[model samples]
Target: MTHPARLFLDRAPSPIGELLLVTDETGLLRAVDFHDFESRLRRLLRLHYGDLALETGEAPRSTKVAFARYFAGEVNALSALAWDTGGTPFQRAVWRALTAIPPGQTVTYSELARRVERPAAIRAVGAANGANPLSLVAPCHRVIGMDGALTGYAGGIERKRWLLAHEGVVQAKPMPLAT
Candidate 1:
């Protein structure tokens, strides 16, 4: 039987909340989520990795710097971060399409489905988006409802709204995340 990996777990503060970052020994990002949603993170880790050994450690320096820069208003800062994930081919395709969504842009689930050439699988696309393990690094927050409403962010709607505003989708001043 294959053995799951021992990953490094680190926590950092972001405007949204405390971020939990998991990376492999080689420093490749394995997962990212809010501290408040650790249960979800653990669930995803199990879903993808079978079982894992987590050590209290820091993420790679470059990854940390990139995230800090993104939080500092260099929204495209994460475009170059190194990360990895595993899923079905369709899920991988949807996650890849998400990265192509340039900073400051938002697309509906229908449009994301179209990008992956599964124009009729909008619901499936939404499910894949939800299963995204590398949140901001994958840019899944940029996806919105078909009617342009903020919808279904695992991180919470207020954080999603703050992210959209942080990316300049709305001109209003950024709001603090709901506690």
Candidate 2:
């Protein structure tokens, strides 16, 4: 994902909230974030791709259809969609690892850190996870703390909880998640 990408914008309703999907002309997903987090979304887009026009347009049919299916109970619908993001090599690696996490499973930041082969980079992994532009598609919500406690999620903790339940991951939380 180079800077100054010509990205198209689309919106779709989901169980959690309204999602704004950013896609390249070729239908490659560039980003996905909630409409309520428009400011954060803008900041991330700017940070990742620099200056670019996010024109008002419909995403490709496949992109829209995939999301529809995803929210409609076809949990694996998103696995086939092509997405790319602009980030440092490390961030990209972390995002790829996130995608590898199956929908109904989770891994701690330390575990994810080791998965990236940078065991000492747990904090760095957490930072990169925070910077991920793709939300549900990248499945960043599946990353948790080492104590089986839900940690920070860019989409918010409640949404993370809903997503985990939606995916059938039952966890015994040892601590309270801030509302």
Candidate 3:
């Protein structure tokens, strides 16, 4: 079995603050909290990767390159690169559907659930959305509450606002820095 190990880390300064990006041996893990890298990484290691050891380093060239393109708004599609999104079969299915949601567009959680043939599984769909690991790459931020209000985001609501604003969904005062 492939053991869990830290691949690399990079700090990207954004409008909100400096985001700590982490990746595993597979692909981009998540943008972690700015100052809580060690603690959050440790918790993630235990919860997601079990007791596997972690080593801090630079992000892989491929991922770094992809992120660069993404941040530049020159690329929006991310079918390339291997991702280890730890989720159940149903959740994976939901996340795959999320990727189909084009940039600069938004989808309600209920709509996403219905598209998955899980009309009554709205809450489940939200759970799967909250569990999305690739975050912006997977485009989970595009999902909103039924009332069209920002519901929940693992990376915090401010980041969600930035993502939606970046996509031109809900117009904010000033555009967020890409990526």
Best by TM-score: 2
Clash totals, every prediction: 0, 0, 0
lDDT string for model 2 (1-179, tens) is: 45544888889989789999998877789999998898888888888877887888898889889999988888788888899989999999999999999988999999999999999999999999999998988889899888889888888888888888888789826348459
Give stretches of model 2 more than 4 Å off: 2-4, 172-179
Model 3, residue 43: C-alpha shift (Å) = 3.2
**What value does the lDDT take at residue 27 in candidate 3?**
60
lDDT tens digits, residue span 1-179, model 1: 12336788899889889999998877888889999999999888888877776779988889988889999999999989877777778988998899999888899899999999999999999999999998998889899886777778889888888888888887323334469
- Which parts of model 3 have CA positions greater than 4 angstroms off? 1-10, 13-15, 26-42, 75-79, 171-179
Pull out the clashing pairs in model 3.
none
What's the residue-level lDDT of 118 in candidate 3?
Answer: 92
Model with the higher lDDT, candidate 1 or 2:
2
Tell me the spans in candidate 1 whose CA falls farther than 4 Å from its real position.
Answer: 1-4, 171-179
TM-score per prediction, in order, is 0.91, 0.94, 0.76
lDDT of 3 by residue, 1-179 (tens): 24445555665554455556667656655434444334654565466666655566666677656655665664473446556645577987898898889877888898999889999999999988876656666788788776677777777677778777766786323323459
- lDDT winner among the candidates? 2
Error of 2 at 96 (Å): 0.4
**Sequence-dependent TM-score of model 1:** 0.91
Candidates' lDDT values, in order?
0.86, 0.87, 0.67
